[model samples]
Every structure is written in structure tokens, then in C-alpha cells.
Target: MRITVADPAVPDVVALLSEHLADMHATSPAESVHALDVERLRAPHVTFLAARDDAGDLMGVGALAELGDGHAEVKSMRTAHAHRGAGVAAAVLDSLVDAARARGCTRVSLETGTDAYFSAAHRLYERAGFVECGPFAGYGEDPHSRFYTREL
Candidate 1:
């Protein structure tokens, strides 16, 4: 798999992102969703990444929000359902963390649903060294979700 920063103009990345957002919404209530839409991902503070197969099929994507000089948040992480359990999510996440650290971020965090549907994500984050934490970046406590963080 090839992982790299994405150009929002690309249609495959856009379609993959749209599918990812829909899946997130499907797994939980809209209020519990924390994904960034394409328009929001175009913001100056966000960095979007795309992972594709050798033949250029979009397999996964994720984004990082630069919170400040040393803080960042992981958002919109997803892998195609057909590619689940193939390490696409982990590859994307590892790359995201490396990029964050290179940008001088000391901490990286994420908000994900607490429902059983998201158990795989919870485990992924934990294995990547993220630990449970109270909301950061002004996110108030929400019973529908859990927050995790790690030193980058």
C-alpha cells in the first residue's frame, strides 16, 4: 500500500471519504460522529492522507487537525470494508502519527464512539499507544463516545 498526502481535487479520495463518513454515521448516531466532511477537510489546519493499492485504488484515508503549536487530533480514519483486517487502518494511523511528530506535535488525540460497533477502532488505538483520556480541545464529555490520547 502507498500512503501519502491527498489532493482534495482527486475524485477517488473524495468518493472514499464520502463512503467513510457514511459508515461512521451508520455505526452510531449523527451526534456521536466526529468525522470531518470534505469541505471541512479543506481547511488550512487539517492534513488529509490517502492510502491506495499499487493499481491506485483508494483503500483507506485519515486526517490530522493541527490544534496548535504542539497539539493535534486524528480524525476521519477509515478503511474500505473489503480491506478490513488487512492492516490498512494501522498503516494509515502509523503514518499519521509519524507526520504529526515531524510537525512538532507533542500530543495527538482522537474521539471515537464507545458502542460495540467501534470496538475494533478502540483496540487499534490502544495498540498504537493511545490511552483513555478526558476530552481535549474543548470537547465536553459525551456518553456516546470515548476520547484517547498519546504523546507523539
Candidate 2:
């Protein structure tokens, strides 16, 4: 799969992103939804990417949000339902981490749901080197959330 920073106006990327957001909202009621809307992804601090096959089919999407001072947050990670378990998410995540590192970020963090619906996400994050942590970057403790952080 090819991973590239994208302008949210790209039609394929926008459709994939819409599906990603809708799936997340369907899975958890209390997730700290990231601001992945088109304009938000174009913000100075955010770097959004969409993963695509050679044929141009979108396989996954994710973004890295600069939090300043060598810190960044991972956001909007999602793989197409049919592509789940096909390494699409892993590829996108690895690219996001590399992107953060290239930007001089020393650490990367993320927020995901803690409900049963998120167990798979929690597992994936752990496998990717994220460790459970208290809220960072202004997020407070919330029973509905699980926070993770990793050194880049």
C-alpha cells in the first residue's frame, strides 16, 4: 500500500475518512473523537495520510497532529472493514510514527475508547509499543477513555 499525506478534498480520501469516522462513532459512545473533518485535517498542526492500493483503492487512513515541542498525537486511524487483518492499519500506523519522528517528535500519544468494542484497538496499540497512561495534553481522566503514549 502507498501512504501519502493528503488534501482532504481528494475524493477517495474523503470517502474513506468518512467511513472511518462513522465506524468509530458506531463502536463507542464516549470516544474522544479527533477533529478529522476536512478543514481540520488541513490545519497547520495536522498531517493527514491515506493508504491506497496501486489501483487507487483506499485501504486505510490516519493522521499525526503536532502538539509542539517534539510531541505529537496519532489520530483517525482506521482500516477498511474488508481490509481489517490485512496489515493496512499497521502500515498506516507505522507511517504515522515515522512521520512524527521525521518531524523531530520524541513521543507520540493517542486516545481511544476503553469499552469492550475497543479491545481490538487496545491490543493493536499495545503491539505497536503504546503503553497505557494518564491523560496528556489537556485531556483529563475520563472513565470512558483509554490513553496511550510511546517514545518515538
Give the local distance difference test score of model 1. 0.90
Please list the residue runs of candidate 1 whose C-alpha ends up more than 4 Å from where it truly belongs after superposition: none
Q: Highest lDDT among the candidates is held by which one?
A: 1
Model 2: colliding residue pairs: none
RMSD of 2: 1.6
RMSD to the hidden true structure, all candidates: 1.2, 1.6
Q: After superposition, how far is residue 145 of candidate 1 from its true place, in Å?
A: 1.1
Instruction: Indicate the residue-level lDDT of 64 in model 2.
Output: 92
Quote the positional error of residue 30 for candidate 2 in Å: 6.1
How many Å off is the CA of 13 in candidate 2? 2.1
Candidate 2's TM-score reads: 0.91
Q: lDDT values of the candidates?
A: 0.90, 0.85
Write one digit per residue (lDDT tens) for candidate 1, span 1-152. Answer: 99999875588778878887888788778877888989899898888899989998888899999999699999989897778899999999999999899999999999999889889999999999999999889888889889999996
Candidate 2 runs further than 4 Å off: none
Tens-place lDDT digits, model 2, residues 1-152: 88998876788777777876776677666346643777788899999888888998888888899999899999888787768899888888899999999999999999988778788888889999999999989988877779999997
